[model samples]
Target: MKTITKIFTMAAAVALFATTSLNAQTMMETDPNPAPKGMGFKVGVGINGGVFRDKSPMDYAYGADLKLQWDLTPYVAVTASGGYTKLIAKDNAVDADFIPAKGGVKVFPIKRMYLATEAGAGIAIQDGAKTNFIYSGGLGYEFGGFDAGVRYEGYVNDSASTTYFRKTGQYAVRLAYNFKL
Candidate 1:
């Protein structure tokens, strides 16, 4: 039964990955990147990364997410994002994979330039301590149905830290598809 389940899980993962890649390609091929609908809500997927310091060594982490956002003003927007992540080092001692309940505020005060901040709470993979207050901010450009973004995310343990170097922070460059609903 375990073997069957493992195979099933692997097959499912492959299927989903293929689908997303194909969808992205199709959109790129057919769409000339027109401006998305304005004054409405948008939702899409994104990827992220971060690193943490533990007793043993440092762990490098990567994550993927789906986000739903609402335009609160021409210069402000709010987003709900959740997704999977993994942290790796010598061995998988901590929960590298997690689906964090997170939110962000975005502002485009200047043309073609956006600034945003985000925070969240989540359960990590395995038995690692539950993470609290995931936060990030970045700059981005909105181009038609596609956006290019650069952001940084920080992961903090439930216990407070006295120094900045003790926290886990990941910097990322992301390209995302935008849609209206």
Candidate 2:
């Protein structure tokens, strides 16, 4: 949809601007503690956009989420997030919209780089729509206070008969701003 495209474009611009501006500042100053103090909590808000897999009636997907993360160690963390997503339908098809709540783990193999996995339920928002099981995995990098990740997400429907597609997936990019809590 046009709205989704516009939002995605705007988010990309903002991210680029922030990254360029902050990179210069960070290079000029080195913090003694680049990582957070031991075992802390962080909160983040993000927006995502992606295209649906082939043969799907949906044209694109877009969403926003709020996440809470607890750092278990410098190399590990646990996260919980909830979000609203909309899969824009192709012509003559109905849209799919849901709210997803997920919990997962993040492992930092190297400084500021991480791998993540998550699974949860996606609750349908439309009347008579069925719930779905959702899962995702991704890799990302953190710089300054921004986290950018690319992920593949899938949705599975339990019932055989449904108004929406039974199995669908997308590849998405998420850009978030995080802060310690």
Candidate 3:
């Protein structure tokens, strides 16, 4: 599908950017100036858990999240993440399952602490395979190779037929480990 292609393209671009930048950094090592602490690049993976507020019948879904991240600089980074979330129900007819994919940024204010945000698209496959806009923002602290944070994420389902937004959202806490590539 076109959407899947676009997502992969974006991911390739990000990877290419990181590789080129790292190579340039290697070339710069001969210069008098050197990268500052935490100024290099890194790759990360981790797990997350949170509440997924679905539509009325299957409200308050809870699920797990998996994430991948790239730190391009001491102050800036990119993240690619995906996860499965589901709603509990007495019957299968009213249950919900969601698959979400997103890409976003992280900004570190003091090298070890960051304010992060991301926006992308996701597919809600359960009800009717509806595609929607997704976004999230939060802050976290990092020390050693570990990161911990809390973020609020939402799915926008506004279409021509509907005008209201904020129909689904989630509040989650995340912990991750990052390593330079």
Candidate 4:
């Protein structure tokens, strides 16, 4: 499973690079506007909520994130984000909390619509808990400085027997308002 995840991540990176290069070349050749659209830095604040998988002890997860984005072209952007999330406990289970830091690429295939993939570490807030690997993929629409996306995110543990960091997944929705920087 790890191998597959690695392969997928690499493939996505390569695809993003290729697309960005192509788009840059095309824009350089024909774009008339001196000040291009979607060519700047942006900062955003977002909140998310979701349900964990049925087998998990957590009932729901909710969080907020701060994001920085740099538009490479009208079609591609790079992003870095960090956020706090809480895994609300089910009956008799302990709640878990984490801070996740990630970097990713967003590719716009059509106007106002984008696909994104991100990977990073989820640092556990509980003492003695191990950090987990996190990955997510999602699609969203951007309009009037607001972006809304839904994704499937996973936290993968290296050691399944550990108290925390067990493999878990969730489906989450994020809504953010961006400010130009």
The candidate that achieves the highest lDDT relative to the unseen native structure: 2
Better of 1 and 3 by lDDT: 1
Q: Predictions ranked by lDDT, top down?
A: 2, 4, 1, 3
Which candidate ranks first by TM-score, i.e. highest? 2
lDDT of 3 by residue, 114-165 (tens): 8989887766665444566878899998877887898887767645312223
Clashes of each: 4, 0, 0, 0
Show pairs that collide, candidate 1: 50-170, 86-96, 87-96, 95-125
- The all-Cα superposition gives candidate 3 an RMSD in Å to the true structure of 23.5
Task: Give each model a TM-score.
Answer: 0.65, 0.78, 0.60, 0.76
| TM-score of structure candidate 2 | 0.78
**Which regions of candidate 4 fall more than 4 Å away from where they truly are?**
1-38, 158-165
> Model 4, range 128-170, lDDT digits (tens) per residue?
6778889999999888889899999988865742436467889
Q: Clash number for model 2? A: 0
The TM-score-based order of candidates, best leading, equals: 2, 4, 1, 3
Per-candidate local distance difference test: 0.68, 0.87, 0.66, 0.85
lDDT of model 3 at residue 41? 59
The runs of at least 3 residues in candidate 2 whose Cα sits more than 4 Å from the true structure, single-residue gaps closed, are 1-34, 160-162
lDDT of 2 at 85: 94
The alpha-carbon deviation from the true structure for residue 12 of candidate 3, after best TM-score superposition, in angstroms, is 73
